[model samples]
Target: MPEATWTYLMDMDGVLVHEEHLIPGADELLAELTGTGTPFLVLTNNSIYTPRDLRARLLRTGLDVPEESIWTSALATAKFLDDQRPGGSAFVIGEAGLTTALHEVGYILTDRDPDYVVLGETRTYSFTSITRAIRLIEQGARFIATNPDATGPSREGSLPATGSVAALIQQASGHAPYFVGKPNPLMMRSALNRLGAHSETTLMIGDRMDTDVRSGLEAGLKTILVMTGISAADTAEHFPYRPSRVIDSVAALVGSTDKPFG
Candidate 1:
């Protein structure tokens, strides 16, 4: 029997590039995918930058990913809101990526009696904005967050992310936000939908067992846990579930894209 053609959903930060540096074999794998016209999306939970911004950054590292091929938690959140309540209004606390997505989806960004209080990643979280979000949620607006990642990596150290801010708002307003990013399975499903790919023929490659592998497993896709990111070599045994396979990095799968698991 001929091997099934595989579609790829890949995590960006640790798997492709780490701290602005391209990982070994990243360019080669991407070139192969593009050359063959295989469907793929570069996925990220970070909501700070738009896809154009991310594409430029990747280009700086010599990776030629197209802007439209990047999928973000911000985009997923916007899509969810658009589906749940089309043409709704939201008071969003995020950067360009989040705001741009909401705008594209025709959501009205406002602070006056909005229908939802959306929280996303921002380098600087303002107490004033957070206070306003809490008040809006208290006023009966639903709470929604892009991702549940509590901390983000930084050169200095770990920085508090969207999930941390969501926790604070939940404590003050007694309302927990519905996270739409990885580990939720919603993110994986959304990416699959965007690629027009089915879970059975798709492969999810990531460096984290918690977010990437967990989400892919739940979404019924084959998951590959790479050792180049947050999860250490021995990390998989601690998780209740296991990935479909584990590898050193994307470099190992360069020539084996047709049958990654085999």
Candidate 2:
């Protein structure tokens, strides 16, 4: 609010929208940030769709988030692998989002003793694919998952996500996966780096305490918990770590005088 001194890294699903519906005042918050030339990114753990795909979806929902402002777990996972093992091969169990990211990094997608067994978000989690991933991991492939989100929100209801499938693979293969999404500070750090924003001067807005708030805290960014999504205000106290600020929604921050997390 105070001349956009603090940059922002916000969660996409909960903070901005929920299951294809734009949250109240979400568009105004983005508009305000863009109008003031505030550096910001809309981050999401869902790796099922590419940035272009997501931007199209958001536009259909009446939230005009820029394609460049969107960052997905697929991109982060690709970046992580590139940094760790450049041009490495992976046996990916995901959709176009994950496969495309890996390809952009010059990584090969194969099942022939791949360097990593990459897991990501998908609507349909095939048992055959999970079995293949488990077998690959058992044969000494490192397990890498996009996120640890056990459940995903949908118009119908909650659906099993990457984390739930990751758990099953871990149980079978006896190998834990390195998650590259929310709740992991690395993801937050990557977003900060992309924005050229220092952690001390950035604020993270999210609705989930376990993923967004926790990751922001660990990444040394001030976190604000909004009650427009998954984590209710009452549930915030249940977590050991707390957000720097708690508000009813992003609507409250629109044109407010308070300069939070500066």
Candidate 3:
């Protein structure tokens, strides 16, 4: 094997783009990874869109990410649920992405006392659905959430996301959900398994220390914290664990040199 044989698991929102805008050098970095025949996947905690849907969105931002190269918490949640109980059913509170993933995994979507109450990100969460979820959980269905992100960035402002909704349901049902997204090493491990990569030679890049960095560290991958998104330079210092490197953006990782990182 090569001396620096490395694969990558990069966060999507902050590391590569912000909202609909591609961060500077993101394209170049992607090109470098593609050209080097490096195996990598763009990981996102957002379960709002499927990989095919997200690929189109990235294309609009001038990034050509293949659908197969994208991994979402929706996919991870489906895999997790499948591993736990194959061909089971769930009462889903999400959009097309989450529902599609579960369907692909042969999971039944229903509201009739299902195996799990799967919560995920949506443009607008309904109060009625949340009430139903609380009732289901109280009636003995296990609670599962796609991610723990309380709020999501939007054009207007931050909007309540899956975690926020999960909290409300938990408040009513008196049971915390098992969050399957970032900060949970299970998601990272699943991504690594998808890539057939070992943590010893993998890198995790993201902007958030709480989620990205924490998850990567727990997964035993070298972590890089960029400042283009949520976590700032000073914010890293407050975390109990530090990233392997702190850079301004993915731009610092664009070059093809085998010097670990540019």
Candidate 4:
């Protein structure tokens, strides 16, 4: 095993790139570690893109990650729903990214009395849609959400993410959903399994305290919080919890030779 036998779980957006533009040193850093056969995976909450889609996009951007190295909330949600209802139809409120993943995994997407209603971050979220999903839940449909992140990264500022939509639905339906993204043990389990990572030798890094950071801490892995993403500089000001290591960006982790064996 390598000195840093630690498997690193990296978040996709903000941490790796903003939109389609790659961060300055992200590609090089990724290449170096991958060349050394260091184990790592891109654990993303964006259910908009498939593993194969993301793999090819990353390759074009100069990072050579394979399909297995990319895990998304879409995949986790699909797996969870597959276990709950095989070939089930889901009423969705997200992007094509999520619907594509569900479709690929054998889920039948529908809105006519669906078996489950999966909500996500959709630019087109509205009262009508929320009411429809809420009605379905009230009528005994299972509820699922991609992630509970309330805010997302954007040039203008933080926009309402899945959390906002989820909160609304939960408010109306009087029932919380089964979230399948960060901080959820199911996602952590799937990620670790795919990476062949042991909690004793893995690191989870991200920018959100409630989701990414909290999830990493819960997974019994060393956690690093970076300021390059959603969490601002003074984010920890009112917070009691802190990550194991605080860095300005993923660049700080680029070539650190420290292993996680301790």
Candidate 5:
């Protein structure tokens, strides 16, 4: 495999792996990138796990990814709040994963007089929890969402994802949240900062247009959409926004980026 023209930002779930299994050829693609110092990170919208946890998961899958390569919406959410709100208190309508990450970053998470409301894909979401979130937002509390992915398919089938919860919060609060996952510049900026590269020199590869392509485009990086998870051949034409390059899978970018863009 030859070195790519620019640094690559890789998406997890779809572009690399599927649940607890690695997608076919993912290891070879990732290994080629690492050997060439392609400068890629596992950008994931799933915030259920921390970066440390993600690192371990990848290792278990036989992909020796470093901790720094795993960047989740959980970390991005904390960074966004810390920058925008600056020591502000938040009422998290999310699971322990979100609140724990927020607390680790020195943000105050409290139920009383919270300046903002944070929402994510929480299995614990109930009427009482949602009602409290709406009440906070109604009282001038700002709203923040981790990701906006509507459905994530697993071995079981398609299931409600982070985007569903984000939609619910927006509908009830009558105010859309500032997203922090892929497609939202925050995730790209964080990865770029860590990789020490500019958008002109970076290439983001993933399977989702709304998230990966949008995020890369917003960050001024070249986008490559792979057809492994969400986006497919039929849906490509429907997206108002398109990636710079669309490949069948990450394997295309591995040995050679020689294929023509469709």
Candidate 6:
């Protein structure tokens, strides 16, 4: 496919930036995409921040991604809920990102016998909230989580993410959550739908084989794995599946945006 015709779905944290530092050539690639008028969305499984918030954060890192160019798991989850049960209420255990998306979707935030118990990323995982979520799930509230990421990266180290807490909730309530983020093709399909792009013509870029590459592959988009984040050079070999291309970083693709992939 001609590169000019290729739309893109890119992972945010590892592929673009790492904890407030811009990956080399990330800005250039985005500039090229924007300059060429290519359709692209910066995707993130982290539901902690809304697109607006993320855009601001990225701008701070010297990456000028527009708010509309960002897509979060929170938004994807909200979209799913809106489609499944419009105007439904959810007992949420998350911050503004998750809450704002749900709100925008006409979903009510409530703890009183809601239609679903929605979970997302939070810096502080409250014991009280988790207990309430468990009880609510046991009381017949359907369980939903923004993402299934077990851990998230931090300057300090790895921190427990939504998936880990979801496991605890499932153990207590005997109900597993339906994860709505990366590694789930639902996330990728929803993104493509949002971008108004076809999977066949879109490219997915990320650093992880487990989530990014896997989801892109499942969604039938060409996947490119970069070495700028969690995955090492040999990480793809351990995976049952492989990315369409593996490069050192987004840096390598700087001038090749218009070149056809072989």
Which one is best on lDDT? 1
Model 3 CA RMSD to the hidden true structure, in angstroms: 1.2
Candidate 3: residue 44 lDDT (0-100): 95
For model 5, the superposed segments whose C-alpha errors exceed 4 Å read: 1-5, 256-262
The TM-score of predicted model 5 comes to: 0.88
Candidate 4 versus the native: TM-score?
0.86
Error of 5 at 124 (Å): 2.2
- 18-47, model 1: which lDDT tens digit per residue? 899999999999999998888999999999
Instruction: Give one digit per residue, the lDDT tens place, for model 5 in 38-79.
Output: 677888888777777788888887778888788778878888
- Judged by lDDT relative to the true structure, which candidate is superior, 2 or 5? 2
- lDDT for model 5 comes to 0.80
Error at 118, model 4, angstroms: 0.7
RMSD to truth, every model: 0.8, 2.0, 1.2, 2.8, 3.2, 1.4
Name the weakest run of 10 consecutive residues (lDDT summed) in model 5: 253-262
Tens digits of per-residue lDDT for model 3, 1-262:
6586689899999888898899999999898888888999999998989999999999999999999999999999999999999999999999899999999999999999799999999887888999999999999999999999999887899899888888888888999999999999999999999999999989899999999999999999999999999987798989789999998888888775245455
The alpha-carbon deviation from the true structure for residue 256 of candidate 2, after best TM-score superposition, in angstroms, is 4.1
My TM-score estimates for the predictions, one after another, are: 0.98, 0.95, 0.97, 0.86, 0.88, 0.97
Model 5, position 44, has a per-residue lDDT of 85
Between candidates 1 and 5, the one scoring higher on lDDT is 1
Report the poorest 10 consecutive residues by lDDT, candidate 3.
253-262
Q: Write the per-residue lDDT of candidate 4 for residues 1-262, one digit (tens) a residue.
A: 5454667888877778767677666776677678778888888888767788888888776677788788899888887888778899999988877888789879888879899999877766788888899999999889999988788766887888898889888988898998999889678877888777898778887877777778888888778778877788888665777788777887776666254323
Candidate no. 1 TM-score: 0.98
Tens digit per residue, CA lDDT, model 6, 1-262: 6444888899998899988899999999999989988889999998999888999999999999999999999999999999999999999999899999999999989999999999999999999999999999999999999999999887899999999999999998999999999999999999999989999888999999989999999999999999999899999999889999999899888877765275
Query: By lDDT, is 1 or 2 better?
Result: 1
Each prediction's Cα lDDT score?
0.95, 0.91, 0.92, 0.81, 0.80, 0.93
| Model 2 per-residue lDDT at 60 | 86
